[model samples]
Target: MSKLWLNSDKNESVFIKLFQIINNKYPNYASQWLNSLKDFGKDWEDEISNNISKVFGPEYNDRWEEAATGYAEFCTEALRAQVFFEKHGYYKASSYSDIVKECYHDADYMKVRYLPGQYLSHYIWPHHQKMLRHFVRELIPKIICEVSIFYEVGVGCGMYSQRSLQMMPKAYGVGYDISDYALEFTFNVIKKHNLQERYEIKNQDIISSPIEKKADFIISQEVLEHLEDPQNFINGLYNATRPGGWGYITAAINAGHTDHIFLYRNPEEVRTQIEKAGWSIYDEQIESNYMEKPIELRPTIVGYLARR
Candidate 1:
């Protein structure tokens, strides 16, 4: 619904009239600023994007119709607001905080699960659980133990550590990230899950986060590429793994992700480095990063079971 295309003619006409009213009412206002906002056209209103296709039938290209309908709504609001502002002068408001205010927002880590793709946290969480079960069985198979301690890098929305804690009893997890927004989102998820006792959220660049002690099992999933220098972090993680201990790592290989400033691109890079740091690669799997690209190109992501 938020992705709808809009009606050009109608939006243009509406904009023209709105501009006229603004110009008439506020002759000295910033036209350039207003012009820059012109790109919003009419789609600023996301309400109609979903229904436009169904209501307009096949001829009305739902994209354009939804866009047009949404713009119609926004244009009206803009007109009213602009006129009111021109008459009433200015209202005082502070700028948004540097960090995102996602605490009140929704996620599975917290009590609510409104975050799309979160309730269905099928990506890394499942694999983390699988690896934990495998590692724990090897560690203390007799007791129905949980992977109670976990550290997740690039903890986007905090699902990785959250799921780990859910699967393990008396568990404690930490989600570390640099972005204030990412941390805020992670914290919100943590709060929602009422996991304050077992889980800790921190805003730290994974590459720089100080590790004094080795973890029972380190869980790093799909987080290597974004660092300025991932090699040091990789080596440090290896050094942090205790002998007979496990660290399950995952990375995308030969993929072009924009946020990915660095690319693990090869599972060998991870495997080789971990081995040098005294960890042996127990098992490695090549999964379709895209499931469509040629096998080599789709080298997409690789999961390595590294034991020190």
Candidate 2:
């Protein structure tokens, strides 16, 4: 059923037609899923269409509708999982080092999950990107007034680096990541934004390879949960930032996804780790899933701006 929508060769105009067919075929699932899109209003179609075109170009006709539906499906599935966990209170837990080791051993996991069109179509465009956009927007004043040299760790698609460089003309940035695919994706994103002059990226381990020069600001969004030694990672962010500089870091709280290994059950765990690294939280945002009955039943994506 997901394959039908994901591979369908239809564009935005055929959304209603596909919805009708889906409603007829899977009446129960379609009702809830279709209703979810209503939250975006009448212009949701256009908004998603433009996003699809912008992210994948006009040739990715199959992607436009899936980006919208897939997101709703993800929300529904996440909500279901959350409810199950809340009801049973049984959960799987693993050591951070073990999960980090598994991720390093299976490098392809990051590539297939991110690498531009993949995650952008499947997860980010639908689920995480808007929250990130809003987060960055709210911090725009800080970006413009305070930032100079920005360092981004695990810059998956370079969206944050691109936006930061765009918003701050005087700011130059360097991005570090362990994956070649991520580096390539960041390269393309920088190229797409015509920001070749403002950014430089390196394919290196951010934790092991010491940052030779300290930066005024740093961003490590959604990357902490992937590592085993988050304390060390936080310390690395601290080392990367000069004294009085700022850093924005984020991680998932009870958000169980395919590659999400480090499950911080509470956002305070993240704050404690950052504070241990000698940073103070300036602002925080915790976004909850929309379809959850109690809202708190769903996993929360947490972000924080910390100053050294």
Which numbered prediction scores highest in lDDT against the true structure? 2
Model 1 Cα lDDT, one tens digit per residue, 7-58:
2244333333333333444334324214323433344212122222222222
Worst 10 residues of 2 by lDDT: 117-126
Return the clash pairs for model 2, or none. 96-228
For all candidates, the clash counts are 14, 1
CA-only RMSD, every prediction? 17.0, 5.8
lDDT of 2 by residue, 181-253 (tens): 6777677767766787888988777676888899999999888776667899899989989999998998877
Where does candidate 1 have its weakest 10-residue lDDT segment? 91-100
Off by over 4 Å in 2: 1-51, 60-113, 116-130, 290-297
As a whole number from 0 to 100, the lDDT of residue 270 in candidate 1 is 62
lDDT of 1 at 161: 66
